[model samples]
Target: MGVFVASTRPKVVVTRNLGPETMPLLLERDDVEVVVWPEDTYCDRKWLLENVRGATGLLVMLSDRVDAELLEAAGPSLKVLSTMSVGYEHVPLPELAKRNIRLGYTPDVLTDAVADIAIMLALMASRNAEEVTAVVRNGEWPKRPWSPFMFCGPQLSASTVHPQRTAGFIGFGRIAQATLKRLVPFGLTTCLYAGNPATPADPAADAAHARAFGLPRVARVGLAELAAESDVVFVLAPGGPATRHVVDAAFLRRMKSTAVLVNAARGTLVDTDALVRALRERWIWGAGLDVLEGEPVIHADHPLVKEPRCTLLPHIGSASIETRQGMAKMAAENLLGGVLGHAMPAEFTGTK
Candidate 1:
């Protein structure tokens, strides 16, 4: 009689340490073998390629590029790719689709977290938190003179007695709408959004959104109008070739001097060079940003870092403990489902 042996279990390669809350989801699974980078930071590219040679599943982060090179390195056994992010710009869709590989991502879970940050950025920029906080941090407040209008920029709030304040959004999607809902309580009277011209407008939906927020005005307008009229403008547009550097020199020049700019979206959407020039030239009041172009590689002498009028965060929009854990759990489920030939909890279905 010939002796029989069991087949080896499929492997899943994770880019980074998914933390205590999420790591167990895969570690506890007896059906698959899991390999993690074991570091809190980004996984080394060289190590990733070497380990993913025969992985049936890959759990990646936004920092890891899911391009042709990485896909090819993963070999024929690579059946699923999951990322703990809402955006899929880092993933090469065409390549994944061509290979018949399933792709999964976390989306709505981070919407509220990002929206909260957007509002925080708006206040930080408008209130000159960067400069004022620096005064105290550098111990200059003791020596500095104070005045009533010393740091005044613009008010985010508007009352019935005061002039109405308008909040403009570059892309009025889920996050944008959630942000608007928050702003409604802060006395936001008007809302304006500018979306892709290719996408047909829905007047009925817009009307319903306006009614829900009890805003007197909510209209879809062109970029020029949004930049000019907005008291505070939020750039929530997706990043790609089409929307790259949408807020360039021309758009900056059109904005009101008192208008504050808040960008929690992709960094490439706003040209960094143009923004530096705008801040230096005082084209607008100030700016707050979470994501920036060429981030994680920013030098100490980077131009934005030196600019006092700009408040910058190192891409911590969805860093809330609850949201991050939720995203990771969702991503793990997605990878497991795809590997088992089941429907993913949140599969990428291409752009609507």
Candidate 2:
């Protein structure tokens, strides 16, 4: 790799005002000049393109697109780029490689936060909180009489009726492991996960993982088995072409009718149409989601939004105050390190 530097102080174009916790890392430094988007929302493309001309470093959120055009706008002076997100789907990584620009991203800091949301979604969907709460909020609760099964839904905790509880993860990465750790107190007995087919199963590792979690069984199984056996399937995988629509009609059909689906991962992982049909047909108990295929544009009339059995959150898996501050600090550090030609705290290596 080559280290490129400018003759004058490095100029960094930040797509958002990363807040007080992170502004000092760049503003206080005389070595770098910071240009940040003044808006409370995502930076405008025209404004970004115009300002990025002479920048040596750039800090962007997930909404910003980093492609060949953006690189052309940035010129050869651009030596480094950082995104304040774990997923880099918005960025065309090869474009950065072609320009010899180092890339940095914050990943592990939001693991626990995202895992917390996953469990919260699971609980919300399992308990029918969204629908029942809506009835109360709409003034329909007072009109209705209490019954034996008025709002009864599936129970998440292991109980007398269900002695054994199995937890399934679509992709068992850091977030998935954290989710499993949280599920331990819920009296989970088994943990099943699906992995990349290219990587063969390691029974020894699986056994040790199960032992660490105090679970009797932990196996790497096929998607079919994972869907059919799991009581609550948590999708915590990465998003891309290869993994898109992993939860299609076939996968949904294979799931237990009593099971609930929770997706904190990318929306592309699940087919929205298929999920809508699944919920309508009662293929599964309910669903909880933090992301959608075409988000921020999802209207009130969107099919998923209308489904009472589905609980939707506006992609707030990592929206906690503490987690956001940590991510902001990390993103600032990454930008400073790259601009100074030093080691970034969380530099991205294009490897699995």
Candidate 3:
């Protein structure tokens, strides 16, 4: 009888522990060797580089920079990169395409979770919850002077007396549309969106969306018009050079003083310094943000943190238990599929 030989199993390096629910899907696979970063926080940069050497597949978070240097560290053995995020800003797509590597990301699963948080942030910003909570937490509520209008801000919906509410979106993608759906019950009368000008206009589609959402009108408009007309403006645009600082001093200055600004999208879409000045000068009613520029490094003295009108969250738009688990499972599936030479569920087609 001829002796049988076992083929070498492909190796995969996951950047972080994927939690109890999803880690086993990778660990129990006998056809692959799985290596995971033991730390809960972003895997140490040096450690990631060392472990990625000779890795056939890589699983990363949005915090990981999958650029030329890291790609070089992974060597030619790397065939696939999977990220547990909807956004791919941290991944260098052109470099990945140059190397003929497939990319995968979590997308649709996060839409609802993020949309919910967008609405929550809008409410928080408009109600001045950040300032109110600070007062209560600092034990100043008892000594503070109470007035009828104290802690009051603009209402999200139009009252019976003033029944016209307009919601503006910087990007009318899935999450933005989901948020608009949620806002329909709040009596939103009109919807305005500013799409990427590079893409062709689809007025018919916009009209369809408006009809489906029960809004009297839904149309694409210029950024300046959107900033000026919205009762509450939601920034859901992608992050990149073209979109960076799209919402700056000039844009903020155009917004209604009673309008609220909510950013549940990329931090770079809004200029941090400009936003600080906007809040300080009361250019707009208040601002709520789930992501911020140079986040995870925000100091106690950060101007936005100090600003009473800015309600900040530590990027928890997709923090729901169900949503995170789905993201992790899909990311693992994508990594395994790519390593096994199978089709990825959510392959990044931008490079293709």
Give per-residue CA lDDT, model 2, range 1-352, as digits (tens).
Answer: 9998754877899999988887888899888988999998979999999999989999999988888888999999998899999999998888888888989899999999999999999999899988999999999988989999999998888999998999889999999999999999999999999998888999999999989998999999999999999999999999999899999999999998989999999999999999999999999999999999998799999999999989999999989999999898999899889889999999988984
Q: Go through the candidates in order and give each one's C-alpha lDDT.
A: 0.91, 0.93, 0.93
- Lowest-scoring 10 consecutive residues by lDDT in candidate 3? 2-11
| Model 3: lDDT to the true structure | 0.93
- Summing lDDT over every window of 10 consecutive residues in candidate 2, give the lowest-scoring window: 2-11
lDDT of 1 by residue, 294-344 (tens): 988898799989988899999999999999999999999999999989989
TM-score: the better of candidates 2 and 3: 2
Evaluate model 1: give its TM-score: 0.96
Clashes within 3 Å, all models in order: 0, 0, 0
Q: Give the clashing pairs for model 1.
A: none
Write candidate 3's Cα lDDT for 1-352 as tens digits: 9989754899899998888999999999899999899878878999989989898999999988888989999999999999999999889888999999999999999999999999999999999999999999999999978899888888897788769999999999999999999999888899999998988889899889877987889999999999999999999998999999999999999999999999999899999999998999899999999999998899999999999989999999999999999999999999999999999999998942
**Candidate 2 runs further than 4 Å off:** 1-7
Task: Rate residue 222 of model 3 by lDDT.
Answer: 96
